[model samples]
Target: MKNYIFCLLAIVLFSCSPKEQVQTFMTYNLRYNNPNDGENRWEVRKENVADLILNYQPDVFGTQEGLNDQITWLDSVLTNYSYIGVGRDDGKQKGEYCAIFYKTAKYNVIKQSTFWLSKTPEEISVGWDAALERICTYFLLENKETKQRFYVFNAHFDHVGNIARLNSSKLIFSKITEHNPENYPCVLMGDLNLLPETDPILYLSMQMDDSKGLAGESVSGAEGTFNGFKHDKTVTDRIDYIFISKGDAKVKEYKVIDDQVEERYPSDHLPVLVEMEL
Candidate 1:
């Protein structure tokens, strides 16, 4: 009778304890919706984009330059996932969205919101010297099984503004600190439009660890994330990145998925994937 009681107690404790959790994250820029993109139009390449995500099945993924219809279409095809974000133009269904999607079975969104990367974060305003409207979308999610919660931010900086990029990075850091003071294992992923050595990237690196940099010499896959639909190695640049908050998670693997089908690419910017254990 004593032995049986002890066994039952142990089982109960084990069932209630937190389990080790591993998650995959991907950031891809879908290149927006363009009717005159010739062979690279959204209609022509949408299937490949969906197929790529289906194959990898990232636990949480973010996309930049995705229009309302484009995101809606993806939401339709990615049946097991749900997303949160608003258009950058008017805080509604207009312009591009930096949308973040997550698996419904694994995680539940507790809170989600979007803010423009401007001085007035509350309103639909463009920041200092930015060429176009930019926004960042984030979600506070709780793991269903372990009950562990974390934050994920997805963003896109202005492509043509030098000062805007720097300020945007600072704004992002401030927002993270403001919203997630507990610093809940945050993950930041996006097409930042800046290189690894640039000031904006450097500023962000101070706050988080670049998954690829953590990989160190063990890094594998393509060196560059932008393909520009040309798929030429010489004409490419490394602008997309995935960064995880310091001491929040352990990086297992980092990859720039360059897979193609019959000479056709999924998107102009390659998807960067990071596997992490929390």
Candidate 2:
């Protein structure tokens, strides 16, 4: 009788413990829709992009350079996912968006918000010397089964302004630290457009643990993200990244997805994918 009671208690305790959560994150710069892109137009590469996402099925993903129609198309195809973000120009669909998508079946969005990367973060305004308006979108999600919570921040830094990028990094750090005080397992992903040694990158590294740097195994794949629609150009610089809040998650795998079909690539910037445990 005592043995039976002990066994039952052990089973109950095991069931009550929080389940280990493993999630995958992907960051891709869709490369703004432009008629000048010619063969690399959205219509030409969308299916391939969709197929790639469906095949890997990341638990969450952040996208940069996505215009309204482009985001809508992705919304239509990714039936199991829901996204949060606003246009950077007017905060109402007037310009490109940095969108974050998550699997709806696995998690619920408890809260979500967006802010411009400028001095006046509250309004739709450009920051110091930024060439264009930049924005960051964030999602606070709760796992349905485990009830665990986490945050995800998606962004695109200015490509033309050095001061803007530096200040933008500081702004992002401040925002993240303010909102994520509990240190909930959080992930930041985006097309940073800066080299690894840049001030912005270095500052962010101090706040978060990069998946590529923390992966238990060596990162396997291409070293760069931008391809510039040049099939033969060797990609050697990485400007995209997925970073998790320090002490919040464990990096299991990191990959730079550079797959192509028939010499047709999905986007100018390859996707950065990471698997982590919380």
lDDT of each structure?
0.91, 0.90
**Native-referenced Cα lDDT, model 2:** 0.90
Candidate 2 has its poorest 10 consecutive residues by lDDT at 14-23
lDDT of 1 by residue, 92-123 (tens): 89999999999999999999999999899889
Candidate 2 error regions (>4 Å)? 1-20
lDDT: which candidate is best?
A: 1
Number of colliding residue pairs in each model = 0, 0
The digit string of per-residue lDDT tens for model 2 on 1-278 reads 99999999999997887653888999999988888889989889899999999999999999999999999899999999989888998887879999998999999999999999999998998889889999999989999998999999999999899999999889988998899878788888999989899999999999888888899675878889888877777787899999888887778889998889787679999999998887
What are the models' TM-scores?
A: 0.92, 0.93
- The TM-score, computed over Cα atoms with residue i paired to residue i, of candidate 1 is 0.92
